[model samples]
Target: MNRVEEPLLSVSERRIATRLCVDAPLGAGQTVGLAPQQAHYLRTVLRLSTGADLALFNGRDGEWRARIDALGKGWASLAVIDQRRAQQPEPDVWLVFAPIKRARLDFLVEKACELGAARLLPVFTQNTDVSRVNCERLRANCREAAEQCERLSVPEVAEPTGLRDLLADWPADRHLLVAAESGHAPPVAEALARAREQAGGRAGVPASAAPWAVLVGPEGGFTEAELDALSKLPFVTAAGLGPRVLRADTAGIALLACWQAWLGDGDARPPFRG
Candidate 1:
């Protein structure tokens, strides 16, 4: 009979590592509490014992070294040993996409976190299929992804907003990049270069000045009127993602990777020198 080896830790271990490695300042004898789900994960799933090590972070706090204190029905606790690593912020990129079905939407959240998006914005367009959002679930997904990806901060998942509302009150100085289905649009690389140029000068730039947002429409894409309205905005630059017609989630993630490759921190700190 073949034996299956148990993972050294559970997927939830990522959360522990994130806390210790990405967010909290640890010291020997410090402690952290785990929520119900986390407790269950350690006890039931991973079968971790007391005295095992776990990691932890709190966004503001630096990473810390923690050890499992105890495991219970729906809760577990950890004692912080020492500081591991300091916190470092990612790019100022934001992902604004239309909500799709539940499964795909969940996938989008996970991928967005992995892609280094600082924030996730859900926009409702005329052609959009999903109207409501489960903010709590998406937030949980972001937390898990952050833990696994070694992200210092979890991306902010904003409440769903109407597309028109988003545009009308849009920040004038912020750059908005819209992914259009038309192949006529400029490539993402070019758009990033242009956005930086439009942004201008280092002195006036906000630390968050990268203040950029990428919009991926619904599966069917933007309605003609919606596209026209988006295009008319001077701050908006529509970019093409090559030939194929991508589903809403796929297009959103693809554009994120492309944008990151060009204008994001993932690149050699390209376009803008700091």
Candidate 2:
């Protein structure tokens, strides 16, 4: 690294405050265009002008330094500079939950992204009260959260689907963790710890860090039949979050945090930008 021609990034230079997730391709000697909303944010909210420096990242390309070439009321163009950080591996954790209220749902999406969930899935369970989920809004929240959290990629927000349909076509390779409220089951940490040991021992299941999905039911819990059906699925594993009741959003967030702490990449430290 010391022998490279390009100057190495300093700790202060690595810590840029303004990070934007753009759809345009990023590379040296390329022009990246910002969307109307992003332009508005820079122009009005941040009061940034031409030649101001910021960081840009797309889910595909790695993070890059950019200098503003043009700035206006609703449009901005930037000249992409050298790369700051290369794309790195992230956990394949997905949050599948019943849609809650607007505010709570937004918060859930943000926390899930910061907590290293690779995807967001809103499912319609038997007891779900919400009929329709606004996916576009969720995407906006996810993108903002990813940018703020210094993540190289934004978590994918899947279209809302029925629980029945989801499980019917669920991939055999991925495992699903269902939060059980009523029945007796092993604690989440215990279950995950045991599974981790088994996986390390070369059991039938894949390694502990494999892709996983966590399912959180709606305010009104799943019906008896729903539980039975889910339990019968080979890929589904029920884990208890303790005796206390938890809101739909809370349960989802807690489960993901627990998984990351137990089986996911909890050992990885956040990148130092300062």
Candidate 3:
């Protein structure tokens, strides 16, 4: 983390790449389209050819630098070669767990998109034991963990709904933390300072946006009538990330790393620059 932050990063053991390898503003004539196992992990396990470079993201387009334009007989292409680091602003968090089994539900969607969680929502609780998941293989492992964790944006995984219709249409301005095992909650920094005192200062609408959804319960949890209808939700809180009892994928990455260590931006943000 010195040497002036190593000029962001690069590394490339011929696609062994680093810093999510290639941040946006590219260079050699642009074009990048891959998938089909990342064009077979770049033409048969990183043996790339036809101009190889590859590293792009379109979750609101940010990181780039591409090449390999067209390698026939099954597909492999790229071009866009510039723009490296310009898409930032992603902390409208949301995780909403409850879908275990199968490699901890792909390590809880790769640690909730590597702990930035802009949306994942896969709840089907009532002590859920897998009601059906594999949402396109967890959306291709959240798009290979947002292109190896440099993430411009790619969390939005929803569509499992029904923890009583996601708390009977709960959206009283987002902020639903809920990691309750009911050993008398409230301790993730006083439930995020009482959700910024119920967001009474209005910063980003939808009720002064901040702490948004982590709610992980299952592996025999949450069902005293779904913790009394999520304790009569007034935008539910009930935190608690201590005293052992985690196991719905380690309480969904310990409630997304304690809500990214107290209302994420994961310590001045970096992993998933969007």
Candidate 4:
């Protein structure tokens, strides 16, 4: 387990090659260290050198451009030069879904991150097909998606919780958008449009709506009793993704996309987009 202890960057100037989302605080003159895996990626994989520059963001201070002060086998440090973008408000939408297979779960988490979901929650329903959820994998997928999508913050991954318990302890003000298949639910856009109108188009952190969450059941779908229970919640609004049946991953992404377009940050443009 020997670690490299050499400097990765030379004194010469270079443009940023990539952006990394780290857990360290970002600031000017701050020397942030990279995790072992990240160091390995830059050293052995990317083969970046001592003079290279890269962007760093911690979902806190803001995005910074940093120079590679040093890098080794399992260690790397960057000297934060300046902030490229100030932290801005983002949508507070949460994606609460049942765990599907590994591949689909990976896709779901990635798409959820790209779609601006503030949180990633996995819930176990009575008809759920999977018992165990790999939260670490979901986190990895989320991290990569955030970096690639130019998002300032990575969605928080929550531990797996039972549907009943989750519902019982749910936040009072947060509205839950349940994706219904065979119910009297309105279309996803139609439902969110109504809620947006009711909220009077505030256009704040999450556009003009209150806190919201999109829930998609397992592939087998929710049991009749579970659906009935969710429908009864005062904060729950069952929304349909049309007549065709969608896979759990598809439904979650589709519903969240519609929600963002309607009530979330639909009007806000990406900071990086020119």
Candidates sorted by TM-score, best first: 2, 4, 1, 3
* Candidate number of the best TM-score: 2
Please give the lDDT score at residue 204 for candidate 2: 23
Candidate 2 lDDT, 1-274, residue by residue in tens: 2212435466555677899999888889999889999999999999999878889999878898888999988899999988888887777778999999899999999999998889899999889999999999999999999999999999999999999999998988788999999777678977787766755733223323477899999999999999999989998888998878999888988998987877677776777533
For candidate 1, lDDT tens digit of each residue in 209-242? 5667788999888988998898889888888877
TM-score of each: 0.82, 0.92, 0.38, 0.91
Clash counts for the predictions, in order = 17, 0, 20, 10
Q: What does each candidate score in C-alpha RMSD?
A: 7.1, 3.5, 13.5, 5.5
lDDT of 2 at 195: 64
For residues 143-216, what per-residue lDDT tens digits would candidate 3 score against the true structure? 77876777777887878988988888877877687887665887877877555555652333322255478788
Give lDDT for model 4: 0.85
User: Which of candidates 1 and 4 is the stronger one according to TM-score?
Assistant: 4
Model 4 TM-score relative to the real fold: 0.91
Error of 4 at 37 (Å): 1.0
lDDT of 2 at 153: 94
